[model samples]
Target: MTKVLLAGESWMTHSIHVKGFDSFTTSAYHEGGTEMIAAMRAAGLDVTYQPAHIAADHFPLSAEALAAYDVVILSDIGANTLLMPDRTFARSEPTPNRLRLIADFVKGGGGLLMVGGYLTFQGIEGKAAYAGTPVDDVLPVALMTRDDRSERPEGVVPAIVNGAHPVMAGLTEWPTFLGYNRSMLREDATLLAEVDGDPFIAVRTVGSGRSAIFASDCGPHWGPPAFLAWPGYGPLWANLCNWLAG
Candidate 1:
């Protein structure tokens, strides 16, 4: 089985409510990758998911730790989470730069896949801010320096441009997506699908490893329920993981 470590795709929300002259605060935690993880696991891949808060402290800190998994996936998580762990942010202690570690891991023949969201690739208001990081160099696309989201409420359907690629195997028709992160395809990368004149799915070989980008969320609000229910969903993810693991 392909060993995969997926970081992010979970968030916590805090809200205040007012009724009459009283106010109350509420907090909730949510995961957006439940279906995606199940789909990958059903395909026989061993997936270890680390939500945003957990990943801030628990994401791999060394090449040896990263080597335990064939692929590392970053989705809906900002660079700061991995960059400033507790030791570095709170204790004023020097810590391993996880972004650089991931970059080296890819160069050392590991696989990397970045799925887009509000906090993935140069996200909303540029808060995701992955443009100039070490991990940016390892991605198949060049991220913008500012906010890169393309809102397509009218529904944008991705078109297959590289049907022959292994990642597209058994995937013929694709459902519409609500939005996606816009990125420039790197010169050395292969584009598998495209939407709104941007690279929707792109892949590249980095040193002895491989890297790919899925320019949208694995679930809503960028990925709609229709897409999650699409018959090709499971096969698409499986094929991509297998191709990357190889």
Candidate 2:
């Protein structure tokens, strides 16, 4: 079994209001890490999900902890969560930095996958700025801006750029993305998919490890409806996971 470590914020409260109504209410939201883990496991991979509800100043906690997984996944979380000012940004002693540790892990042969969201790769309003961090150097593509986010309607579609790659093997065409954060590709990056010429999916190899960036939300509300409802969703993510682990 391929050991995979999945990390992200699991709980969220969103403010929503009825259409054309002024009244608003708060709704709960959870990250898609668990869903992806389940899908991967169903496809025959060993997945261990480690969700961080609060930000940590130091990364990985321990080198021993970092060595336990073959792949790590970051979805829908900001940089501050992994690189807080101190071990306790609110109040605590400074300790090991998890972001730096993650970079080292990748450099030492651990695969990484970064999924898009309101808080990933210079997310909405520049909240999840990851441009200058150690994590950036390992990613396949460069972020567009620390503050810009683009949205596509329900019917908007994504085009495949590298149809022959293993990641795109079984997936010839994907359904429309309800929306995605916009990003640009590095000249050396391998473009896998695009939307209106902008890179939607990209992959690259760093050291003995592999990295992939999916510049779109993989959960409800932000991801394409077809992604969750489509029959191929499981295989699509599974293949990506396998590629990353390799």
Candidate 3:
């Protein structure tokens, strides 16, 4: 079985309410990858999740620590989480750059994937900030330095650029997405799919491993309810992970 690590896709929301003379604020936590993880497990793969809040404390800090899994996925999490851990910041203690660990892991024959979201790729306000980082050295596509999200209020559909590829096999049709991160194509990478004529999926072989970029979310607000319920959803994710593992 291929073991996988998924970091991100979890967030906290704060809400405030005021009426008459009383005021109250509330905070809630949410996770977006329920279907994604279910799909992977349905395909018989062992998977683990490290939500955004605890990523810095729980994410593997070295290539050896990361070696426990065959694939590492970064979705909707900023690079700073792994770059500047609590100890490194609050205590001024020297710490390793987990992003660099991921880069090295891929080069050493480990698979890696980066899914898109508000805090992924260049992300909202470009604060996700993976563009010039060590992780960029291993991604199959190039990230924009500025904000990269392309919000499609009306929704857009994805087109298969390489239907015969295993990643696209069993994917007869794709669901419409509400948004995605725009990425530049790499000359050495194989483009698998596109959305609104932008690179949607790209794959490449690293030193002794494989790497992939999926420029859209596996769940909402980019992936609407219909998309999450689409018949091809689970199979598509399973195939992507399996192919990378192989």
Q: Judged by lDDT relative to the true structure, which candidate is superior, 1 or 2? A: 1
Candidate 1 regions exceeding 4 Å error are none
TM values, all candidates: 0.98, 0.87, 0.97
Off by over 4 Å in 3: none
- Candidate 1: clashing pairs of residues: none
TM-score, candidate 3, is: 0.97
Write one digit per residue (lDDT tens) for candidate 2, span 18-89: 777467788886656655667778888887665656434223677678888888888887888887745367
1-246: candidate 1 lDDT, tens digit per residue: 899999999998999999999999999999999999999999999999999999999999999999999999999999999999999999999999999999999988999999999999999999998999999999999999999999999999999899999999899778899999999999999999999679999999999999999999999999999999999999978888888888
* Highest TM-score against the true fold, candidate: 1
lDDT for residue 120 in candidate 1, whole number 0-100: 97
Q: Candidate order by lDDT, highest to lowest?
A: 1, 3, 2
lDDT for model 1 comes to: 0.94
lDDT of each: 0.94, 0.76, 0.90
Best-fitting candidate, measured by lDDT? 1
For candidate 1, which ten residues in a row score worst on lDDT? Answer: 236-245
